[model samples]
Target: MSLFLALVLLLPSSLCHRTKAQWHTCDSGFSISATAMARNITHCRKLQTLGAELGINNYSTTPNSSTSIDVVFSALPPTPQGWIAWGVNPGRHPQMVGTRALIAFNQPSGMPVVNTYNVTADTRRGCKLEPSTIEVGVANKAANYSDETGRLTMAARLTLPPEYNVSKLNHVWQVGPRVVGTVPLAHAKTLHNFDSKETMDLESGVGHSQRHHDIGLREAHGILSVIGWGTLLPIGVIVSRYFRGSPIDTKNKWFYAHVGIQILAFSLGVAAWGIGLSLMERSGQYRAFMGHRIVGILIFCLATLQVMALWLKPKMLDKYRKYWNIYHHFVGYSLIVLIIVNIFKGYAILKPAPRWKWAYIGILIGLSCVALGLEISIWFVFLKPDDKKAQTNASDPSKTSNPN
Candidate 1:
């Protein structure tokens, strides 16, 4: 029994140590031996979204030549039964459709197999992905899965088509959960899965993620819109409402402040609107954001009218001054409401980090608190005395009597 206990303890430790060593080896670098005619890999890149690595050995006569290359892709599957894939899209856009891929998975008999697939739009619709010839010439294909490290590595030598450029190659990589027989089941529709494509320069190993670039633009647009329409516009309204007639109106400085703030806010809003248009053109996701785009256009038109109304202001003693005031107040308040609603809509569309959404919520709450306090103070300071004077006058019969 003592011997048995010792053996059990040693067995777990040995297995753990071996597993750790294997993981380190796999994560550190690709160790598959190069082909007999292969040159040393000049470039290797860690993909941004998926936890995958790619190593490339370019055999082109020139940097821009469309020659052959050897590539190795390594990644850990989402599950032990899952599969891994790496591919190139010859199209101008880097996406899953129209990709030539090499997919690797293990069979029930524990044998690793790699197959070429020509991914079409139908493949995205859950069609069975079968082994087929691709546009590019493929040879020297091999794949292996390491049980200890849980890593799948696929190596291939590809001959490029005449039109292919070695400097700008669109590549994609993915990991799936399971395979039904030889066919890979659908991968989870997560953000990481959608963001598994990028453009790479095989010669220099430089990669640029299109998703990251788009995200950066979106963040800029969100920030500008929040500051201009959501935050500053409300503050301008508050200043015009409360400070214009208050004791702080020396030299009518409140008017200038309101004007300056509104103009600045409008400028930023216009910039944000322009950026939104650019993003729509680039992404072509207009239908998804139709409501948002319409609301944004409405806000822009109303804001432009408000700015123009500044120049068309009536004189203080003009007969139509009250009508102008009514229009201004109505439009201003309506804009505030629409701005808040559209900001929330943008938050839903962007789906940025949680902290950003919460931060905007906190800003709105703080602004509401300030507005509520000011409203109560205004009622007490201005409206209460007038009400009390009218009551006093009504109580006194002499003061209430009209001069006939």
Candidate 2:
């Protein structure tokens, strides 16, 4: 009986009550840990270099034959209505292929559950889960409330399939309303795709810092482009056309106004272009919005040609002056049309704050109304026959007729 009891004790406790997965505490946050299943994961990555501030609280990996990851968020639950999530991407953007995320949210009953997603490159319903996909169990779930920060911390585990390779992991994070469910992009308040600071061989952890430099750059570019190219340029055109015949200060008042506005607009446009290039560099997404780039470059080139024409302008008495006018008007009008189109394209591509798009559209509508009013006035001021001549010609048919 004694021998049998000793043998029974020697048997692993796993055979009786299942042992919990091995977990080791981490020092990065208030309280964090990695399970034995997680530490065996040899691959680890760090925070994104840009737009990192708006993303995950913490991200780590565990890799061997199968892959596992630990994601933590400090601003998730107890916030009342939103959810937080983290995922791995094949590339540095959330829209990239083979992108998958693990999300956490509190149910209406206040019980929290972890979910997974497959994301696509879209503005709405960008993250999706397969209809038949099952909800896999998560290893450990922990949460904490920090009185110092007045923030709640939540962490969860994800076990990936055998085909998952942690070495190629590109981390992504998002926070959105609880209504999003498996499709976080559909309702995400903020989303980011970032590069880890750690090298593949280093096996080190990285912490994220919030930065809005890229977002600021984007806003500056949009403002400059819309005001300088979209709004001011059209106004300059209208002033040159309508004010040329104005009775007040008719000595090239239109010319001076046109030149001043054009110069200001050109300067702003150049600055906007520079900011746009910088934004593209920071994002490393040069190839994504090819249409916007092409249109923008065309507008810049045509505008530059117009500026040069001002210097090389033909004199009014020159035989080629008519041809010059035609070329100038065609190029100028084309630039305006293209600018309007590209502004809309930018709205669709950037998917910016509602105010940005609405404000731009409002300006565009106002400009269109101004142009229409000027066009109608032009018929009476310039195109219509003189009333005195019309009456004299009506009284004398022979004078009205052209004699051979």
Worst 10-residue lDDT window for candidate 1 reads 18-27
Stretches off by above 4 angstroms in model 2 are 1-170, 173-211, 383-385, 393-404
C-alpha TM-score for every candidate = 0.66, 0.55
- In order, the Cα lDDT scores of the candidates are 0.78, 0.58
Runs with alpha carbons beyond 4 Å of true place in candidate 1: 1-44, 56-70, 74-85, 91-98, 102-132, 139-157, 174-196, 208-216, 250-253, 283-295, 311-331, 344-355, 390-404
Model 1 TM-score, all chains together: 0.66
- Residue 281 accuracy (lDDT) in model 2: 74
> How do the residues 83-138 of candidate 2 rate in per-residue lDDT, one tens digit apiece?
55555554543333445655566556656556655555543334354322323335
The stretch of ten residues in a row with the least summed lDDT in candidate 2 is 194-203
Candidate 1 clashing pairs?
Answer: none
Per-residue lDDT of 213-271 in model 1, one digit per residue for the tens? 56656666787799889998998998898888787589889989999989878977887
Per-residue lDDT of 114 in model 1: 87
